[model samples]
Target: EETDFEKTIVDSLNIGFIPNFLNSFLDVLSTASIGLFSVLFISFFFLKDSNLLQSGILAFVSSDSEKRTVHSIDKINNLLSRYFVGLLLQIFILFVIYTITLFIVGIENAIVIAFLCALFNIIPYIGPIIGAVIMVVLTMTSNLGMDFSTVILPKAGYVLIGLAVGQLIDNFFSQPLIFSNSVKSHPLEIFLIIIIAGLLFGVVGMVVAVPGYTAIKVILKEFLSENKLVKSLTKSL
Candidate 1:
């Protein structure tokens, strides 16, 4: 029965797997392409006409707090813009590092794989783990017929080491600098916020944690200027 089951799987793969995989991949790619263009257009509109968002938001502000609200909004906009640009640079740096490592290991389609994996790093704590798993799976599959113990394991190990280096730089250097300079928060504060947000609200929470936290800090500083904790947190802002 086991042999028969194995044969059935092999038959399915031989008959339909490649085409099915390609079709599914194309579907995902098309959707992602559409999302990418939509995001670009929206970002361009917001960046070009920044006051449109400000005006819309300010409509809800009380007349007494209007001046303070406008100041907070300006600070939020500047900080978030820097934060996002820093994130893009971080991903690009990882992509370059991963590409170099994959090329050195002679991995096929290194650039595309590296870029995809690098993009995964945007998700915070869990992102790198997912990227590493995908990287290892792709690396092994790229050399499917090779000896698993000798060729595949060693190559995957090399890629893992490369990933570790990229992660170290991101965690220690890139992240701290981005958080401090862009958002005016301690690395530890941002890390804790991201973890707590992830636990409570999942991946989406983690993705928005920094921006949300930064906005909150800005608001708190504006309204609670006399509070000691708020003063400490937002002093750098």
Candidate 2:
């Protein structure tokens, strides 16, 4: 009986579809594997030579300025490390929230969908939109043969609501805390920067705004300590 069911499914599928799907899947897997390996290989070297940036800086600076240069480098490293670590924690928290919510909604592969969406958080404003779209697609496909009203609509609606709530928490609580504590910037300052960046350059602008602003503040404080604007902007730093 099981053999007949399997045979029926295989025969019902378009002959070319299976081959094409397998080929596409294989290609994607191969590409992802290569990229993953490349990142790991590069990360290993970066970790092993953690002092590479300091060494490079020292090599470029005069002997008399070495101390100040070292101080600046250390400050930048500390600030960036905190920012990145906080970002990771925020993403993890969001992932857990999304997974639990989707599971409650009776979505299949809830964990996987939630993970992808949470990971997209790294991309800033555009990430959530993309994640939500992906979630809806996954939910619909998972219930492909089910009654639309009874299964699909409810599942998809719940998934979307969950994503919306998760994003709200992230934006209001997680993001503000991370930006304020890690970057030593005021929540209002971070908010304004993001808004301005989005206005000027769209999604990419918003994504890079915080780090870019932090870097600028650090550099200005280091080089233009006497400047009034620099003093005010970098007081926290």
Candidate 3:
């Protein structure tokens, strides 16, 4: 169904975005190399306009059933603001760690790879894995499957180590900072949510699936049945 929908849309538009996506890869790597300043500038310009944020928050908290909607909005805004701050900090930390590791490993094009890894790290679990996979494939394929001990092995090893340590930081600190007090679904549920979203809306949907699921769950918890069964069915860390 989604394939059909996507095809129809593409056919109607007579456009393919695959090249657009691929063509932007170099530009993306270049932007990443600019370090924390670029990301901070982006967040500041796009997200720091408090007026739009306030209005959006007001609309969400003022859902049809809310009574103390205004108060709720304030609290929710506070929580989200804190989460946003923490997310930026986490990204910065990951960027610094990867960049330092790259330097330590003496990889020639390490800055570009580290930047790519840091940028991709924004997506949490899948992001790091994807980055690691890409690096491994590049290491293997670029050298024509050369002897690992001579050329590819050390690079792949450091990339994996960098990803592993980054994941630890993400799980231990970032998840708690971001998902606390939100609807924390079980791992299976999260996986299913991603699959369903991918089926329905493709790559973009999969990217946003978990957070979207969390929003839906939060709404259900607040307004739907407040039953033990519902809570148990949805519970997870």
Candidate 4:
């Protein structure tokens, strides 16, 4: 029966699957490559002639506001660049921690799994939970043949523990530093913004909250430099 079942599964998979998958994969790869090359070409020119673009944008503003607009643009650029770099660094740190921990716990494809989980950290609050679920599923499937008591539960538990540890490090250390330093917001302020955004718009809101908050703060500081609340909130910016 087992052999028959295996053959049936194999036959099913063989029925036009490989060709269809290969064709779709090739199409996706071609499209992605084209898009990537286009972006690179445009970015190269943009970087080379950034001043021209800046001057053109400033030309639209009245002469009196041009200086303030330039300052605002510079501040926004600096803050966003640092914020993105900090996020990248956070992901790298998480990837390293996860890879080492999962490998130590004997999970299959630990490096790839870690990389994926780390990338998911780009989405705030909910992303780590999703990554952990994926890790557990992968680990359980890898150990499918093992006895449930002796091998499966214990190994899965160990993997979960490792993930929890990595998350702790990320939450307590990496995140605070990124929010406080990159966006120049107090950790508490960032925490509140994320919570409010999550409540209002779910995961998408949480993901954009920090960048949006930073941009708003910059603009407010530029225009409302004398307002007391704005003065306090945007002091760091």
Candidate 5:
């Protein structure tokens, strides 16, 4: 299964995406074996360590900033813990979020549809979009998967609203709390970085853009920040 998956990845890689894809695939393989669980766990770890490195750096600053950094780190740890545990609650939460959304928007079978999408949310960038695509396809293809229009409308509405709100919350709040608070890049800057990543390596690149950039930033801060040439260049520039 792993070999086949890797072959498919390698086979599909275009000349431009090949290098980035190779780097990402190798990094993923090194951290853990090729599987959904391993990949997801590594993604979660990337989110966690990104903050840990920042808090560690804060230790180098003056007393007050360092102290606040401590508080921030604690808050971050709490956030990571909550996010980590959220997996268990995902099904219930997705059902509720989507069910309510459908009820308001007038779709039916909200609970069932949303439960499925919650599963997809586990996959990062591809997940939510896929969920929507599946939902819409089902909407068009299937017979409401129910008897009553009222029930069906609420069900469908729930998925759409649930997904929209969930995505919005993630984009505006959860993402910063998890993957981005550590990086401190502005929204515009982050957008530009995503655009660059997308241009270079497609959807997966865009999704992992923030973390990859954060990782590079952390490495530079930790190792290159003190280099004589870096200091001279900084002063000169």
Candidate 6:
């Protein structure tokens, strides 16, 4: 019965599936490569001549607000630098924990798997779930051709538990500390901002939420210090 069901499903798949998938993959790869090169080129120039970039940006500001704008830019730079460094630290912590967990579970290529999974955690909100899925799939596949119920299931379950533990540490300890120290926002505040940004602008919005929110808060405080809401929100900055 199971063999018949499997064969039926296989037969139902479109004959062009493999070719279509290859075409789509190549298209995506080309797009990604172009985007990556563009970003790197721009970023190289920006970093190499940041003062020139800053001067160009400040050229649009009125003389009256020039000083304030400069201050806001500096503040934003400092906060974002710290936030990015904190992210690196977070990834490192996750890598260490994941490597240890995978090693204990006897998974093959544990270091590489842990590193890839750790990198995925950079995406806000949804990244960890994606990482967990990848980890479990990799763990199970490491024992390919083994007995599924006795070996693969138990190993995958252990990997899942380890992922939960790592995430708990990240949630309860790492993230809160990073948010408070680097961005000067509460975890709940950041969480709500990410969710709202995700709803309004999708994954890109969520990815940029923390640094974007921090920049906005800095600008608001610099320009609208007297407004009650702005004052309340920017008090942390």
lDDT-best of 2 and 4: 4
Candidate with better lDDT, 1 vs 4: 1
Worst 10 residues of 3 by lDDT: 30-39
Cα RMSD to native, each candidate? 5.5, 8.7, 11.4, 7.8, 12.8, 4.6
Q: Write candidate 3's Cα lDDT for 1-237 as tens digits.
A: 479889988779944786896667655444433433444454464346755765666676645655544443444444445555666677777777777776765655666776666666655345675567666555556555567787677776876787788779877776565556443455566568878876786445554565456545544455554678657754542
Off by over 4 Å in 1: 1-49
Q: lDDT, candidate 5, residue 232?
A: 43
Model 2 stretches astray by more than 4 angstroms: 1-49, 195-205
Q: Per-residue alpha-carbon lDDT of model 6 for 165-226, expressed as tens digits? A: 88999988889879999999988899899899878865556666787799899999999999
Q: Which residue pairs in model 2 clash with each other?
A: none
Collision count of model 1: 0
**What lDDT does the true structure give each of the candidates?**
0.84, 0.77, 0.60, 0.78, 0.58, 0.81
- In order of listing, the candidates' clash counts read 0, 0, 0, 0, 17, 0
Better of 1 and 6 by lDDT: 1
Weakest 10 consecutive residues of candidate 2 by summed lDDT: 31-40
* lDDT score of residue 3 within candidate 2: 95
How far does residue 74 in candidate 2 sit from its true spot (Å)? 0.7
Instruction: Show model 5 residue runs off by greater than 4 Å.
Output: 1-38, 44-95, 102-116, 119-127, 139-158, 226-237
**Tens digit of per-residue lDDT, candidate 5, span 1-237:** 569889999989779887897687556433322233554567677565867666667868787566555555554445445545554455456556766665565446756776776656644555666667666555534545565566555555555666788777666665555443345555666678878876786555654565556545534443466887545422311
Q: Which ten residues in a row have the lowest lDDT in candidate 5?
A: 28-37
TM-score against native, each model:
0.80, 0.74, 0.56, 0.75, 0.47, 0.81
Candidate 2 C-alpha error for residue 174, in Å: 0.5
* Stretches of candidate 3 exceeding 4 Å from the true structure: 1-76, 137-148, 181-192, 225-237
lDDT of 3 at 82: 59
Give me the candidate number with maximum lDDT: 1
lDDT (Cα, tens digit) per residue for candidate 4, span 2-41: 6988988887775577789768755644443343345335
